[model samples]
Target: MIAVFDRVLIANRGEIAVRIIRTLDRLGVESVAVFSDADADAPHVRAATTAVRIGPADARRSYLDGAAVIGAALAAGAQAVHPGYGFLSENAAFARACAEAGLVFVGPPAPAIETMGDKIRARAAVEARGVATVPGIARPGLSDADLVEGAAEVGYPVLVKPSAGGGGKGMHRVDRADDLPAALAQARREAAAAFGDDALFVERFVAEPRHIEVQVLADAHGAVIHLGERECSLQRRHQKIVEEAPSPLLDPAQRAAIGRAACETARAVGYAGVGTVEFIVSARRPDEPFFMEMNTRLQVEHAVTELVTGIDLVEQQLRVAAGEPLALTQDGIRLAGHAIEARVYAEDPSNGFLPTGGRLLDVRWPADVRVDAGVAAGSLVGAHYDPMIAKVVAHGATRADALASLQQALSATRLPGVTTNIRFLGRLLDLPAVVAGDLDTGLVDREVPALSADPVPDADFAACAVHEVPSGHGAWRADGWRLAGARGAVLRYADGDGEAVVTVRERDVVVERAGSRAVVPRAELADLEVRAAEDGATLWVSGAAGDRAISRPALVRRALRASSPELVSPMPGSVVAVHVADGDEVALGDAVASVEAMKMEHVLRAPVAGVVRLLAVVGAAVVRGQRLAVVEPPTDERRP
Candidate 1:
């Protein structure tokens, strides 16, 4: 038996760090954690045996700074470093640095990371190893003209993907030849912003494609084994939301074939430690699976793989890093039961899945299944990091049972302040296609409207009223109670554009919205969970109807900005670029500036055709609804 390191520094943060710490503690090893100013009070910081400050909140200065991380490891007297995915997990330079420092890096070699890190190179390398890759045009440097010409030959409906990043950050789909040029420009900008490499490749968009990935572990002694597969087709904008093990779409023979291909791909680069090989399988033809790219580190969905295989992947990484050989052979591995995981993000499904952030007022995790969370009550959910707050993983004897268990777990989850996709995930699982295991990449995007059509029920408004009113205030407080000194017994709350007027009577609470009234008894609503924000300006009410966030209406505030022609930032982020100059004439819906947050870019457009007055400067941080630019109507069309 090989001995694990005495001390290891985890070079990442969030749930992954907590997960690695758990394994390190189980094996009696000291786990060192590194955090930035923003993560000083994070859950992962307190979970580690020892912690060190890295840098500031900006990732480039902290998590992405390889030099800072190496310095921290050396100063902490760590024998090794475990990059738990993201940040520098796939950074070849960082891996080489660790090796030079006489520290074991719990991942593949630098050469392997280099080869598999680039999609263009990865596609070529795997294809040389007799692996079937999806037909596409990939190279180091392809100009816009070159890509446009290649797209025509590769046929329309192609995906433009970045050569360097793994997550679907810079990916775009063009269905027609006319739109290929514009898509290429936007893809290049995003690719450069995300990966510092604007190189792109075009591949044919598979109709009804299913994302299947195989987890494999290899040691430095040249032994590799597969740990089955995971289905990750439930996605929005190419980001996976839900994942399950032992894809229901694959039969026994197909699973073996894909598993063999995954091992062969790993062997092509002499990969060591744990790695996941992704494949794109056509839903209509599940037998023919095409090679996608290899993730050189542990995946976010690795929990589902572990649940089915009964293997501690983090422990395997630690052992492999200590120069251990295969503990189990190919034939000895067994895949039992099934597992499903839902990634809970701080995002609003109803608002185009825009990222949301705030102080978490209260967080209650489910008790039944395994939960990997990065935040706790009073934790700050910021815009500087990935919005995924936690993951809920459930295992059962069968696929149906696992699905049901996951749904129940999600319903029991509660995060008061920040908006999450929990309710939407519960609804997505009930969709006919997802329930029957008939999934595709576009399913979530297509069904977004129906899945996000949750409306605030009147009962929730009544619950908020009960929770917000002071004891001596005659049961309810009106909008003008504090401002205008009016002591009315009616409450006025607003959600988005809708308003609700509530009255608390002796035994019943009456709620009126849009000329409809509903009376709910006080005792009947006693079970509703009411969580107030720290400032008491907002109330989150949870009941059988659903979760709702209500706040007192600002009638005067709304009236002042109702007729203002301004283009505002929809989310809190930094202004990356401005397309138009001050006083430049712009048409309606014209792109004015770009704002980036959580690694996603959003373009702000002019609301009316008029001369532009830019108010936002590049590199300035802005908040949600912060005005970025304004359009002044010409004097001929201006209102007197």
Candidate 2:
């Protein structure tokens, strides 16, 4: 057995890197962080004891470059390397490169990675061990006739997936025989783009399946221990949104059976280190759980497992890499509490969940819960990487308490300038079906309209206005005045819906047609202290909603400016195709340009008809609502 390394290099970024660093520090091991140009100022880079500049923000040159990562590890004096998920985590070549460099790769061996990385081979391996897998095809060179025969054997509504891909990439669902060819081609294209593997396979799509995964830890001694299960039923477009521990759907017997199967599958591969066995649990048949795919490295939702079992998975990985034996037996493990995690992404939930990029003006997380974030307030949410900003996790003695905590944490979060899934998460937590543990992969799609609806109440806007008034000028003082006897500066603000007008007179914020008054207490008013300027009153408001700085005069002007003519650019991407000619007549939702970003294609549509005026052309980069085009209405129509 090799000696334990004194230093380890983290070859990734975001919350996972930070998480690894924390564990390394606790283990008395030095940590090295490698970052691209875009992530130089990231929190994970700053938290590392040593940092290395890998390359540009493009993942291909930095994170995915195994040679560069190995060089960085050697240069930083790291004797081991930890690939924190995504990027090169599952790349067999990366693990082999690390092994060749005499650096202990903190994961399974290269051969193990190769075996489990391929969906077809992994399925075959699991099946050989008598583990039940989804009915599917694993062989290659199948023609349209072969595909039809295979679908008939596997049954209808089969899912076509890339043989060498995960993370929902290169996956297509075919409900009928007519759509099989198109689905196969699309899945192959996506697979080639994502994993450089166009090999495809077919599987029976488990209708309304609960995405459950079992965490397994294995050591060099050939012992594998399954760490219960995680319920990841809440998903959007095959991507997990909310993950919880101690699946509410599983009874003790079912949990034990699934866990045993997962352990047997791990042993079949002679697995080591931390890995996850993902399963698709059928709603119609809870007694059967089909093996999906095994994540060879740590999972993004590992924190839920950590919260429930009180075990730091990264630490376990480190230990297992150091050739240590399993510390605890299966009998000794106990899941104490329920835990839930919500991934806060920099995306607009109302706008097709398109990624948002901007400078973070503010970020305030709940103090009661654990918030693992990789960006700060001033950090830039760029198109260079994943749109996820942070993962917020809450643990409680019961699922209800955990749900409540998650809801409270989401509500307490204060983020401005960039759109987030915070409000959507808040609505989701309060969902009756969710509260009752009745969840499915289609929950988001089914209740999207309700989930995406604006949740800020009218009272919130009124409170925001009153909370915007300058402290010394509010009603807290007998003769409220910033300047002696100066009548509280007339403050005009807009309510939540922007329909009602709010006027602050003599330190009292009056909401039109609303009878209730929110008095600014002297103590609370101090917290809302503001500086009076010639143009406006800049006030700071602190409350359960988190802190905010509001400019009284600017708010009124913004409220009025909201009605101005505006053009919104749909999707986050660079304009790839522009067809509009100035003065050309166009109808509503006309295609202006094709915006390509995040490897997804989106066609920018015009909002109205008139004479089309284009501001951006092909190859020009644009952000959300950056005014890419303008409609002049019709020549006969008069401007209001």
Candidate 3:
């Protein structure tokens, strides 16, 4: 087959860009990659045929700058621009700009993007074509008062959603009428910050909602077909955690009905290229699936659909963009084996799932599964990008086999010097509800306490201590031991259950702790991947158990208190809002400030009821564990 285009420029970064470049290379096309200053050394940059630096580290001046992307494409002598999943992929104006510049945009037309990008108009348009949408009050220019009124009419437990943007950003779930006003305010603030549009609508919240989306393909010749559905019910904070093709909840008849509805939705908007039509199905009524929205470009979970259908969705997108007809008909498309994908994010599951960033010391992936990774060893995971670092996809003849394969793949995946959620994903797959194929959007949230309850294992503590503790043979060692025999150093963390007393000798190491004791050979600990911080205060150890971080207990205890009088930022980010001023009286649990990181907002609240002294300034960058505020008892309330 001839190449879709001689040269194509990718207007995105990370794993999706690499994924697209792989397909472009297979089709015998030259790939051009654009990167910000931070991503100049990213994996995608090295994988492309040629790379260009668009702007500085700030995404606004680089990846999200549609004008800059188009200029790079033209300068590189590229015929088309492929906007992979995020950034400006769904921006209608960007599509129009590409067309006006005589560049083929590998996506739907501008009108189609404009119609489906806005949830309000998309809902109305699809409903006009006899498609089912969640019962809601979605319309343009709905004021706050109008939303309040609509919320009451829609009944309690209504969902406030922004008209523009997807990925569950700017969405709030209000379970009571009194909370609607506050949720609406927060939702509007988030919406405006994220998508620059605060327009919101109210919808009846679907209890036990299961997110199922159908993959559809269209050509300019007016042919649209569905490539089965994916079950994306496993989520955290409204973001998908795991996705799989051929949902176990749906039979042949139900799948056909949902597939038809999805096809109708595509035809309604004249959608082209590969797209996903999302639906919200109630666990009670699995047969009746409600249209959620249509993504104008490829989905992050598109790999799963491609694995099951054995179709290269990106290749198809390229062919269609080059004015080719549908390569396969509805009857020709077939679903073979089951495929599952688990998203690996650079986050600490035990630490409230906050985003983590650092230099990746050692990155290892299993060869048995398909791993699409963005970062590698020596790569810096920064705060400017999303937390997702890679995706592990596996295919098997049965759902159980696929689940088991994914679990093993996650265990074998190792990323040191940065925290990850690989262990948590493995545990989630073992949940009885998940094993039985019974899932809902809220399953992850409800089971977070159990899922993140990771206590530092004795083996991990021993390895960390062995790798960090100084040798006792030297008189000038940090251990500073002059006893009759050699003494070891003790290490502990603020959140650790107990201390690890480690004694490193020439031949073997001795590690003792409460309820455990072990003496292992020094060669064993030396072989493990141990990355120490520059300050030598923390050590990250990666072993068969997974990655674990060990901090110097004394240092952490001195910085933090048992009573917790200070409020600190959980991750490195910018202070977006400060609800309390200096010397303001704040009650316990009162929202004092909010830190924005990785496109998510985390509210830091007062830990004690006292007069608060604010330390964080809005729009100022902060580091993880940086003090943001302090609460001191009033004079009258002071005991002394």
Candidate 4:
């Protein structure tokens, strides 16, 4: 019999917290949710049976405060603590604190966490287990000679990563031998800032490698099993955007090999509960998959495995924590239908995917798809948390079917008031490489422009304008009958760029045609919709071109003009470095200033050669489209 807890405290917020809460509720267990000041009304807090306010919005005071979380758990009489993914999920001290308090930690033991949490030690442990890993050198206080020799042996184009880091932070790719020192220094600085670690290690940079991870579940009874694999090759800045179960590039034998290696790795570490073993599958050869690292906690992409394998990973964690043996054997576990998940973020993909914060005016997910979301309509997306708003998951009998379903769901989904990558996601689903299952880490970088291009067709805009125009007050209203001698209201719309305009009347919509008139009848409007032409809804009224498609809730449409010159800023970010001075001469595409946003540095270049007029001082806070500097082009008389 599985030991049961009277109550469980979830020490995190967002979708994963809600996910754990639902599993707890299904087990007839009371759930206590802790929230920071910013997330007082978050969905996780509302879903839990009991709620407690921790501290301020800063994560160090709230979610990351192990003592505070344990205190709240004790205050609520919770028997166990579940640290959902992220915050304190892999914190060894947090797990120990729970143990010292006589509360069960719903994860691996503290020792396992400490041992595997350190990248250098974990690499050594996995290497002892005879698993093939990339060749690299890990040492502390190594001399420059040592680094040079190590790089010579491992070859150039090596990756320098922090020994105690997660995510893509603290990692740098050095292409040439001369760049190694600077790259190492930068990586160490980032690692120190992010993970409190300055130790660096080098590894052979696998070119165009596909990121695949195998899921392993272990119980206290020493039974561990693998749950297939997830293909997470599509990435931007080392963060996964789309993930799918049963990698399209892997065959049955290759999948089995990877799974076996993953289970063996777990055994070597004596792991327990749900963990992921990430691998760098060489794109040049699909048959070879090398070990990358082990995540001792549940992964963000675990939902895809759950959809395909029909398993509740959180429930398994609870069972394993209670000292129950794994219920299924490796042979018994079978992959079912294909499943795909897309991370929906509150960011603008066109603007370097910077984190966006605003009031969510509207949020709607497809009814037919499974949406794991942390916020709802009217909720504010703030800078205090991750930019991910929701994860849309779709499952089907076949990969093609799953991809197609995900495309349809993405197109139908809507989020207003906050910029999102919804349109970009829809285009990704339709990509030929993605549909054909030919994917790797470099795929998104290669296909980003095409995938992010405007999908609305020109003809659709004309049709929408003509159909939206009001008909006459007289006969044949059901059809297209206009009143005798009546002229309908004149409506105008802009083009895709908002640089040109289109005019629509009761009978026809006029579009620009080679400096002449191009009229489309209202009857043709209905036919365009039936054809499902892209760019239909974004059509600007004739006479206004260069307008962006602004889809509000319930199909309310507006065309927004480009930001004026005074509004030029580095999308959204903190000023990291300022290069231009007021009244300084600058040429077209010259580096004006740089800002750090979304963990990447973006250099705002001058649009035209001119004299810099107004410049924001260093360390100034800026918002999206906020003015940072102004440039006045040289007059004809001033030209050389």
Instruction: Residues 458-564, candidate 4: write the lDDT tens digits.
Output: 45556544445435223232235443334443334433343223455566766653255566676765534221113343322111111124321113112322322
RMSD of each: 2.4, 5.7, 2.5, 6.4
Residue range 1-640, candidate 2, lDDT tens digits = 1247888999999888998898888878889999999898989999999899999977889988899999999988999999988889999998988989989899998888988888888998999988899988777565556777799889888888887878887677788988888677656766776688888888998888788999999998978899999999998767888999999999999999999989988987899999999999987776799999899999988999999999989988988988899987999899999999999987767657887776666667788888888888778778767777789999999999999898888877766546677778877878998999988777877898888765333344345555455342534321343332354433444333233444444545445523444443333333332222222344333344433334343343333333433455655567755657777888777666556566554566666677777788877777755777777778789555
RMSD of candidate 3 to the truth, in angstroms, is: 2.5
Best by lDDT: 1
**lDDT of all predictions:** 0.87, 0.77, 0.87, 0.76
Per-residue C-alpha lDDT of model 3 across residues 1-640, encoded as one tens digit per residue: 3355899999999999999999999989999999999998999999999998899987889999999999999999999999998899999999999999999999999899988989999999899889999998998999989999998898878889989888988888899888888888888888887888999998999989999999999999999999999999999988899999989899999999999999999999888888999999999999999999999999999989989999999999999999999979999989998999999998988878889988887889987888888988889998887889899999999999999999888888888878899889988999999998999999999999999988776556666655555463532334554422455444444335446665556566666776667787766665467778655677887877678777765455533443688888889889988888899998889899989888889988888899998887998999988999999987689876
For each candidate in turn, the TM-score is 0.96, 0.81, 0.94, 0.82
Is candidate 1 or 2 superior in lDDT? 1
Clashes (candidate 2): 0
**Worst window of 10 by summed lDDT in candidate 3:** 475-484
**Best-fitting candidate, measured by TM-score?**
1
User: Model 2 off-target regions past 4 Å?
Assistant: 1-3, 141-156, 174-186, 459-504, 507-640
Task: Give one digit per residue, the lDDT tens place, for model 1 in 496-580.
Answer: 5567887766566778887688987877778789887776677887654335566766342443444468888889989988988
Off by over 4 Å in 4: 141-149, 178-182, 455-504, 508-622, 626-640
Q: Model 2, 377: alpha-carbon shift in Å?
A: 2.8
